[model samples]
Target: MDPIEAAIEEIKSLPHDQSFTFSEIARKHGVVRSTLIRRYKAITEPRTVKAVKQHALTPDQEIELVAWINRQNEKRLPPLRRLVQNWASEIAGKPIGESWVGGFLDRHQDELIAKWTKGMDRDRHQADSWHKYKRYFDFWHAKMEQYSIEPRHMYNMDEKGLMLGITNRSQRVFTRRMWEKGELRSVLRDGSREWGDYPCHYL
Candidate 1:
């Protein structure tokens, strides 16, 4: 049975006593007192009330779009925002822009997640395939025992870019002296003056 219908029936089943108020019944049945009263009245009046506003896409059509997105995810190739917008426009029989897409996503936030994928160079991504990494790790682990190699010897290197300050030229920072000593404060060097190499060791 529908939950609302079931709740209405449960409310009716309560003892006909003044102690069992509408608030108590509604709370026990997991519904608002106003909603329970409305449903109760609708039961006797036999008239329907329009509850929700019209949506751009019907619930079934939205579910179909969500299914398509899940299918794309299963294939490990999610569609781009533009592709989704075009698809929605095709289904909607109108030009759907970013604003419409955003609203649609907001409406169906429970079934979808917005993600920003990091940009990767095509050549680098191709060389970093899962199968290649698996093979390399398998070989490395197999030779570990023969070479008496410990986990500390294994390491990975990553390179990243850093942005310097707004101006390229160095600037002096003014500060109050403790005792007016002739010696000035230590120079604050810019850490982004050159490329940095980070070593990640595995243990």
Candidate 2:
């Protein structure tokens, strides 16, 4: 039970003729006097209870939504804000306001986060499996051993083409824990073509 709730119970257990004032009891329980009075008099319910009564999604529905978001993120298809809003509307059986998603995110901040996703080529995404990576690394290690290669002998070279004035970034929601562990960030996209042919000469 919450400390304040426990304190309220204790206050109720006190004898009617007890000399302890409501303020004194509130102080002893480390709770606000006004809040204690309100609760003691049944003038108001707990904030959490009130919030539940007013929230569009029930506790169980919210949990389902959170799970759905995480599943989508795991599949590398994290949802956009508008998409989330639509899903929430479906769950609530009514359209939600623009600000509802913001509040929902705040409520589940520990488990979910919104971020702008980096675009990853579909080919790269398809190759980002554990089996493929392990196979590639095993082949690389075998080649290194055959050649007696040392780390100091290795020189890495990379070449990338950029299309000027083109961006594929989009804001999406992801699981906060996965994001922290560097598991979620990129959104898959087709990289076969570029919007522009502007040359960026390296200096």
Query: What does each candidate score in C-alpha RMSD?
Result: 18.0, 13.5
Superposition error at 54 for model 1 (Å) = 5.3
Q: Give the lDDT of residue 25 in candidate 1.
A: 72
lDDT of 2: 0.74
Against the true structure, what is each candidate's TM-score?
Answer: 0.35, 0.54
Q: Write the residue-wise lDDT of candidate 1 on 1-203 in tens digits.
A: 65556777876786788356778777776777887788788743322223223355666776777677666544333455666777777777777676666776776666565544333334334545567778977988877876778888764321222222222323221111311232222212223212234442333
- The best candidate by lDDT is 2
Candidate 2 regions exceeding 4 Å error are 1-7, 14-37, 117-169, 188-203
In terms of lDDT, the poorest run of 10 residues in model 1 is: 171-180
Residue 102, candidate 1: how far off, in angstroms? 1.4
Tell me which residue pairs clash in candidate 1.
none
Clashing pairs in 2: none
Error of 2 at 13 (Å): 3.1
Flag regions of model 1 displaced more than 4 Å. 1-54, 122-203
